[model samples]
Target: MPISLSRKFQQWVSAKLDLPEDVIMDIPRITMIGHLHLYIENHSGLLSFSPEEIRVLLKHNHGQMIIKGKDFVIKTILPEELLLEGTIEMVKFIKE
Candidate 1:
């Protein structure tokens, strides 16, 4: 379940950030820039993110995570699909 940035996503990010394609697509142990926090999924499946939460569907019980911050905002949300924006203060991963 190694998470990989799609080619289209890579191109978009590279152009937007003026970064090399390889740099933008590199798998990071942990990625945080400005208010964005991204975690690479080790297993492939549906992934969800929010300003204050993250949910990853696994083979077992649903995994739930919480982010703490007052100004957190979900810039976009399509049901389980979402894009989070805010000053990330904390990140917690849970399995259950």
Candidate 2:
């Protein structure tokens, strides 16, 4: 499914409110490093990263990152993209 207008509206509101928008509205790019780390670009959602888990829900998949600690960051985020740096533990793709 495509992104909803409400998400775009939220993005606009976030921009206007000087708030950070969380929602992956476009095609995402994912990368894994050394089989222990992963990077996701163009992601959007309420992200919570900690020593226990890192969770994210994209257009097609929702998953958790198993990390040793809460030492992660959203490297970059734009209206159409985002960047996540951490260790990925699980990934489940939802079928439409």
Candidate 3:
């Protein structure tokens, strides 16, 4: 139940499956291409969307991701992945 124990368990699972710790550890994987494109993996939900901002929910205590930019548009949305395209200006995390 403690943080240290949970971390150890996550590390063990990561090693066993040859997977990145973030995946097993319920963390979002975000990839950005310059300031024009964004890709997110393992997102829980979309909290808000607009031309200038976007908020996505993440698992665990990672909370929500706030993306601010111009001409923001969702290129794709799947059960666990999201692709956004726009002129990205800032990215921040809002914890629960």
The model with the greatest TM-score is 3
lDDT of 1 by residue, 14-96 (tens): 89989865355532223456656444332223355544555444322325555565455655544334345667777675666
Consecutive 10-residue window with the lowest summed lDDT within model 3: 20-29
Identify the leading candidate in terms of lDDT.
Answer: 3
Worst 10 residues of 1 by lDDT: 37-46
Q: Indicate whether candidate 1 or candidate 3 has the larger TM-score.
A: 3
Query: What are the root-mean-square deviations of the candidates from the true structure over C-alphas?
Result: 9.6, 10.1, 2.4
| Rank by TM-score (best first) | 3, 1, 2
Give me the runs in candidate 1 sitting further than 4 Å from their true place.
1-32, 36-62
The local distance difference test score of each candidate is 0.51, 0.53, 0.92
How high a TM-score does candidate 1 get? 0.40
Off by over 4 Å in 2: 1-25, 59-88, 94-96
Model 3's lDDT to the true fold? 0.92
lDDT per residue as tens, model 3, 1-96: 699898898889899989987768867899999999999998988999999999999977679999999999999999889999999999999888
RMSD of 2: 10.1
